[model samples]
Target: MRITLSDLNTKDLATLVQRTITTSDLGKYAVISNHPLLSELKKVYTEYDAVYTKSTYSGKGTDVASADRDRDVSFRALKNFLDGYRKMPSLSNYQFAEDLYQIFKLYDLSLDKMSYSSQTAQMKKLIEDLEKPENIQKLNALSLLPAFNEMKSKQDVFEQIFAEQAGANANLRNMKSASSIRKDLEKALRSYINFITVMKDVTGWELFYADINELVKAAKNSTVADHEKK
Candidate 1:
């Protein structure tokens, strides 16, 4: 029942070790080769396998507990080995970080759009249901008047955060130097102001104080703007 680290594939081994170490209370690995955390996990997994083998009476397959324990121990040991491999200095790569960030951002945007569409569909359904006189009366009596209002509030917050993050990313993309970065940041602020102006058509005075003119004034005070003007 004892599974050696060499028997498992590199990726599987790393994943198991990573999960175990992350869940366990352990300090950071000091020496890349002798990762104490991974070593401890492997030891635990080995002991687990030994206990399972003894309980199972040497592969006679006595019960489910023995089978489950053996499987769990093997998985954990393989995972620890893999985790140790990842902790090795040769495995660190910055491109992986960048790729992961882009992947997560795409996922976030997709989820946001899906949520908005779902809410819109739900509102449509509610309106349709309320068309019947009885349902309308019931809805009013049950105080469901605030359901759409709450949805609107939640959507507004989502939009605000999404827009702000998008604007920040756009500003970062446009940045060439420290001066250009400052200018782009100002431009981003103005873009937000323009967004509010457009929103005013729908929200009216609720967003009236958000003026693009004020952003223009703020941009005029920036050293980057002064340099560009010159």
Candidate 2:
């Protein structure tokens, strides 16, 4: 819960904020949702997201790297899940997993080892193969549709960010730097987190407080992991 928002680069910071507000069921309860600080957090995030979209160059390739890493993890999740599930011969899903694993095997993408460009290209084709009606049915049968959707979403986002990286002709003259907008967002985020920390013992706010706390802890651990890698 002690994440230093400033230490995270643009992509991670934006992702952290987005997940906090959007994924934490912030609007599920009117009582929690109507808080002044919650509204402020949303306002700040809207500006942050818009500014990040317009200020793509501010990431200095770090955003693309982050997107690529996300794609890698998601892709492997689908693959590794199928691989392991297929080994459980006694399970009802074993046959389904085996079928899905065969589809993955056909591609031989080896995404983790490929260069960024190469991996992206291969992933595009693999996703297309997955889209076949037969493959889709098998994935659904094995309860893997959500995982596949997540992997596809991450890939699509990575592709979009990758395209933005080479957009030198983009008109950035009037755009605020993502870093500057992020500072505003960081301020609002800290204020909101502080409020939640205090309100966590209250009845209605406990669920959101727990979810946001977990997100903050994950982000903090990820930052530490990133530092360790360096």
Top lDDT model: 2
Put down candidate 1 lDDT per residue, 1-230, tens digits, no spaces: 01233333333333433443343223332222243533544554443333322321222223323433443343233224333443554544433333322332433322323444453344344334444565444334434335424434444444455455556556544434433333333333334344444545463323232332333334334434445667
Once superposed on the true structure, which residue ranges of model 2 sit more than 4 Å away at CA?
1-59, 169-230
Off by over 4 Å in 1: 1-138, 177-230
TM-scores of all predicted structures: 0.21, 0.48
lDDT values of the candidates?
Answer: 0.38, 0.81
lDDT by residue (tens digit), candidate 2, 1-230: 46678888777787788888775454575546567886788888887787777744445488889998898899888999999999999988698898888878877738667887889878888899899998899899888899999999999999888788766425464566777878899999898888888888898878777888998988887788889999
Q: Give the lowest summed-lDDT range of ten residues in model 1.
A: 52-61
lDDT of 2 at 28: 72
